[model samples]
Target chain A: MRGKHIKTVMVGGIFLCATPIMAAEGKLLATAGLSQLEGSGGGGLVPWATLAGYDSRDETTALLFMTDVNITDYRLSSIGVATSFYDRVELSYAQQTFGLPVGLVKQLSVGEIKQNVIGAKVRLYGDVVYSTYPQLSIGLQHKQLDDDSVATALGAKDDSGTDFYVAATKVHLGAVAGYNLVWNVTARATKANEMGLLGYGGPDNNGYQMMMEVSVGLLLSPNWVVGMEYRQKPNNLSSVKEDDWTDLFVSYMPNKNINFTAAYADLGTVATQKDQKGVYLSMTGYLW
Target chain B: MVNHLKTALLMMSVLLVACATPTKTPISLYEEIGGQPTIEAITDNFIDEISFNKDIYRYFEKTNITRFREKFIEHLCVDTGGPCTYTGDTMLKVHQGQKITETDFNLTVDLLVNAMKKAGLTYVQQNRVLKVLAPMRGEMLYK
Candidate 1:
């Protein structure tokens, strides 16, 4: 009886393995891009119009990413998962831990700041390569702080807020000395301060502010790319000056399943720490 | 009379040489890629690649491989400014009822790239070919 039961279980497992597997490999390698800091698909600091996965019009794709930024005074760790459907829409969730320097933590009695971001993006029009016009997308990131004590003591108005943005991206084939050139422009409206790590709004400003972000990249080959990004920021706190962010990055995609990116990020200033710069390292794994 | 005939023949030969001089234009992309042989090689490689892919192969299940091979070569040649004519049907007409999706279209492009790679095309050469042919995507997709 024992032998018969084992035999039947093995046969059932074999039948289950015969089902088709859906692999979302319709898009080209590296075109989907690395995950942004907020768990959206983009560069290190700014979100672009491209979705997070390689899904095409008839496919669906999902991905997971982890990004770490270590600056002169602080460190941030982020991990997230995102999925795209039919190359049309994307949804993402992320958690971030912002670690304070030991000295600052000792003074403020706070060790870290934690936040969660839920994001959604929709492709509005056109494709990056095939269409005559640039690809356009609109997205939103909703953020909530795990503990509001730090933000409340810092004179922030809210512990939760949302950011809205519209992005346009394009890829020009053989445009730069026979290599592909990609560029994106995004306009965002937000009330988040320091991307919601310091909370939303403050004594200086309680209304949504508009900011601009830009990124340009050169595809050295099919699998390698280098780029730079600049993101303008809003100054909401009067106690500490917030600064804009910039980074220069290199990304490599060995295959469709994985991507690795490293960047020198110049965050300028964060929470009163001046001249904050660091290395940003990230990796993404695609699940079809 | 023999001398006169010889002078006439020499003058006629000079006139023929003068007529052919203006037709010597720069080499075209077809010649740059080694012309018909390379085109045929790419097409052969493409057919082999299609036969191995189940998704793309289904689109060609009813297609006549022999005719496709000939027409594809001619299309590549003409599109590359070669000394040939494309006698095949229009791209839209040929793909009328297929209703190809964007994913499959891109997949087909990937196969073609693989075929070009197998035929030993350099990256730049491959890009050049794609640049010329990429604009036809509007005609092939969703129709």
Candidate 2:
């Protein structure tokens, strides 16, 4: 149909305008250095939200797992899994469980708020890491608010939604003094409506939401990494206007089996809250 | 605050781990490989094999693997913190043409390992070398 053709064309335009081919490839950062990049344990897991996985472009079968803990009185945690195959395609799944028991903390408890996401990433141009070229990738994530009742009971107008993001990643810091830079933007059409009840309305003309993040990864060692990410999501609806977050984390991987991470985060300016900072600790283990 | 504390802990832990665990680079890799001469010999054979390989021969037909081999050594050196700089073409650039599959490249890798063995490398050394080379799957197998 023309509709389908138009949609494909639009998507292709986004890829063409936004990035050039690049090669952002490398091994999974071991635990100690990886935790900071994705807010998870190390090589395989990409912290709280974004999922990079264990293998770079050169890795054929990549298996990874990661998790994250938010610092506010509310306990927000996340876990992710990812795999890359055929050198051009990647698959990932993540579950974010929030408002649960703060096994580590004592006060300010929140109920169980769970969100699940399954994503697919495709490489379109260039390659990172050892390649002189850049590798560009686009991905889509179908997310479900697993416990709609929980989100609704907690006051969300719509409980579940799907989000799609296309990103271009570049990986070659080793040539430039061991520093890696990445820039990405994702426009998401979500059903959760207005930051999930934090704001006012549901999905709007703005199409619900968007996230933009830039990460600079440093190679402390080949299997070790430390990086900082500036992540931002727009407030599209009427409820609780969302804020932005900046974090610095270190990722360390001991081997294929284990990884660890620790981070310092600044939950920056919001509609109401001032600068709030916190700490994160997480670990990941893999079968691969 | 807590993040910095954790970093400090990790740094301290890395030192301890670094001391106790030693680097994972595997000492036997260099030894089992029969050191410098053996690696050089295997490197030559690997170049020869790939130059005639039907699949990826186009990528290296015009290029020499001598610098590539030296660069490989330097990559190992830098990764393991030895005194060297890996200033060679990236894996992606070096293997940019002719379409290599995992099977094709892996077979080549195995052949190189076999060559090393024939040249008198130990199993431990072969595995150790493979460990360092295994991460190259990203760009080398582009179909």
Candidate 3:
């Protein structure tokens, strides 16, 4: 069934690409942000206010992305599709696969975990560059795990959860020694543990908590960007400690059709493992 | 001999002062990007770009190319702090009946950027020009 769904989506993407109502690629280069881990438009670890495509108010655009993170003792891979409508609203779907360490898989009798995330965002006000004020947006991500046995064994209160966030982003042309500078700040409320890979709230905590995230980037040129992002994680699971996430990334956009990003990520500790750090790589292709 | 040396030093200092005074007046964006010739070239290139783009060309089908050329040059000159006045209609008035969509407006901007690039404007220079004109986007979109 999942394979059928993916095939249908790809066919639809190709059909949209051939339609006359497709987006005009109206916005400036690099203005539309890359997909975040949860499939929202943003940096590697933080969601920004910008949408996922460069469409203007009169057009619609769709894109697909794949991301991989190989950290110490674990690996994660995500695939997603996103679309923006008239630059006012964005919707996305993503599936994440988390590979467990050999020892843990043998001990717990589970090799990997899969989760699905559905996201929606609405732009509230302003443009990132043209307006006097920063662009603001509100969004949510609903996550569900494929299986709950591991979560149940780990004392998780739930296998599903939702995260609500508000983000503000801005771009200042020629602000830094004639180079464009972009920044974003986001506040999210959630009860997820390890972004819901290990599951939602634990016995110690069962309520949603607010966390903050930030991203800053400098456009070295119209095609190249260097940036840093920080994401604050919720400590809902008492059995294990959750640490914040940080990354230094470089993105290269040779054209509007595609972009590639590579990052050095520090994910901190997860499930009693200390200092989980690794490289994260992602690619996005614009279909329209 | 002493008097000659003093007079020579005095002349050298006077010349230095004269050159320093003009340097104190910062170069305007217009002059920094090559004055009238570059502006004219950008206008011509912009017109060519519009003519080639079918979507953008529709908006200018009824426009008078000559008047647009003259007025656009003047408008850019004034926006860049050059010595010129805009004799053309206000942006709002000009675009009121057009009902321009955001996509079309931004597409126009992209054409303008291409024009600037062809006219030998540096990336920094192009950004500076965009910064000055970006604030006026509201007047041009969705009239």
Best by TM-score: 3
Residue-level lDDT tens digits of model 3 in B1-143: 23323433454355334434433327888998899998899899999999999989998999999999999999999998888999999999988989898888888988999999999998878887888899999999888
Give DockQ: model 1.
0.15
- Per-residue lDDT for A51 in model 3? 92
Error of 1 at A192 (Å): 1.6
Docking class of predicted structure 1? incorrect
Give the per-residue lDDT digits (tens) of candidate 2, residues A168-286.
44443322221233322233344443233232224433445555444445545534657655555555444334555566777665444455667777655333334556776555543
Which tens-of-lDDT digit does each residue in A1-288 have in candidate 1? Answer: 323433443443343245443557787666788899999998778999999888999888887777889899999988778999998999999888898998878878889999999999999998877788889999999999999887887889999999999999887665554456777888999998889999899999999999888787878878899988878888888877887787889999877777889999888779989889999988777766
Ranking by TM-score: 3, 1, 2
Pairs with backbone N, CA or C atoms under 3 Å apart (clashes), candidate 1:
none
lDDT of 1 at A31: 77
Minimum summed lDDT over a 10-residue window in model 3 chain B is located at: B1-10
Residue pair clashes in candidate 3:
none
Chain A TM-score per model, please list them.
0.92, 0.66, 0.92
In the order shown, the candidates' DockQ scores are: 0.15, 0.06, 0.21
After TM-score superposition, the amount by which residue B3's alpha carbon in candidate 1 deviates from its true location, in angstroms, is 86
Docking class of predicted structure 3: incorrect
C-alpha positional error of residue B125 in candidate 1 after TM-score superposition, expressed in Å? 2.7
What are the runs in model 3 whose C-alpha is more than 4 Å off? A1-24, B1-25
The candidate with the higher TM-score, 1 or 3, is: 3
> Candidate 1: lDDT over CA atoms?
0.84
Task: List per-prediction Cα lDDT, in the order shown.
Answer: 0.84, 0.49, 0.85
